[model samples]
Target: MKRNPRDIIVRPIITEKTVAMQQDDNKVTFEVAKGTNKIEIRQAIEEIFNVKVSKINVVTVLPKKKRVGRYEGKTKGYRKAIVKLAEGSTIDLL
Candidate 1:
């Protein structure tokens, strides 16, 4: 089935750890939609970056509790994908 561009990817999560890992020359990570699968992620990366993907690993993140003054709530859950590209392939999303 053809995947919607909107459903392809959500956004790049620029976190301190992610940035540190990037500087250390490790894997590149991204926050993807919860319903997106491994194959869909691979296709999305390939289509968006025009680069070859070697391997793709996905993980689900649980919600965290939030407290603001007297208000309390839970954050939304999400899915993350760690995309491993070919040795020479690179994506300049930064």
Candidate 2:
């Protein structure tokens, strides 16, 4: 099935560690839909950023527990993808 560009990519991760990665120049990562596969992720990034994707690595994170005054809950789990572009390719996400 053809995937919508917007559906392929959920959002770019903006955190302390992800920010550091941009500075170090190793790998760029993003929060993606749970059902998105490696091929979909590569195509999405290439189409949106106009860059070649070398490889992709995915990680699944489990939900974490949360507590309120007298209640407890768990945060939603999410999937993250670490996309590696070709050596000379660069994405100016900053």
Candidate 3:
């Protein structure tokens, strides 16, 4: 099934590591829909952000068990994509 660009990319991941990568490696990180693939992520980013994507890497975060007081549960799992942009291109996340 084809997904909308906006629907495929959940949000930009803003973190110390991601920020560092953006500055040094011309790359950006995003939290994306779990069912989305690398190709979808690449297209979504290129279309929505208007940046040329050079490469895409996807990673899945497994849920971890946590205990709060008397309750024991697992945190929600999610997928993240690391998109490397063309050398001369950039995305103004701000």
Candidate 4:
């Protein structure tokens, strides 16, 4: 199924590790839609960020159980994508 760029790419993942990867390896991470595939993710990142993507890695995070005072539930599962930009190209994710 065709997916909109905005819908495919949920949000950029900004954390200590992700920031370090961006600086050292030219890689950026994003939270993507659960049903989107690698090719769709690559296309969405390229189109939305206007950057040339050289490689893409996808991972599925399973939901984890959590407990409150008197209740227990599971967090939502989500998909993550790591995109590597072409040499000499950069995405200003600020």
The prediction achieving the highest TM-score against the true structure is 3
Q: Kindly list the per-residue Cα lDDT of model 1 for residues 1-94, writing each as its tens digit.
A: 7887557689887888877765666467888987888988998888887888898889899999999999999999999988878877877667
Q: Is candidate 1 or 4 superior in lDDT?
A: 4
lDDT per residue (tens digit) for residues 1-74 in model 4? 57789999999999999999999999999999988888898888888878889999999999999999989999
TM-score of each: 0.86, 0.90, 0.93, 0.92
lDDT scores in order: 0.82, 0.86, 0.91, 0.90
Location of the lowest summed lDDT over 10 successive residues in candidate 2: 18-27
Stretches of candidate 1 exceeding 4 Å from the true structure:
none
**lDDT (10s digit) by residue, model 3, range 15-65:** 899999999999899999988888888888989988899999999989999
Question: lDDT (0-100) at residue 53 of candidate 3?
Answer: 96
What would the TM-score be for candidate 4 when compared with the true structure? 0.92
Residue 19, candidate 2: Cα error in Å is 1.7
Task: Quote the positional error of residue 47 for candidate 2 in Å.
Answer: 0.7
Full-model lDDT, candidate 3: 0.91
The runs of at least 3 residues in candidate 2 whose Cα sits more than 4 Å from the true structure, single-residue gaps closed, are: none
Using TM-score as the measure, name the better of candidate 1 and candidate 3.
3
Candidate 3, position 85, lDDT: 97
Candidate 3 segments whose C-alpha is farther than 4 A from its true place: none
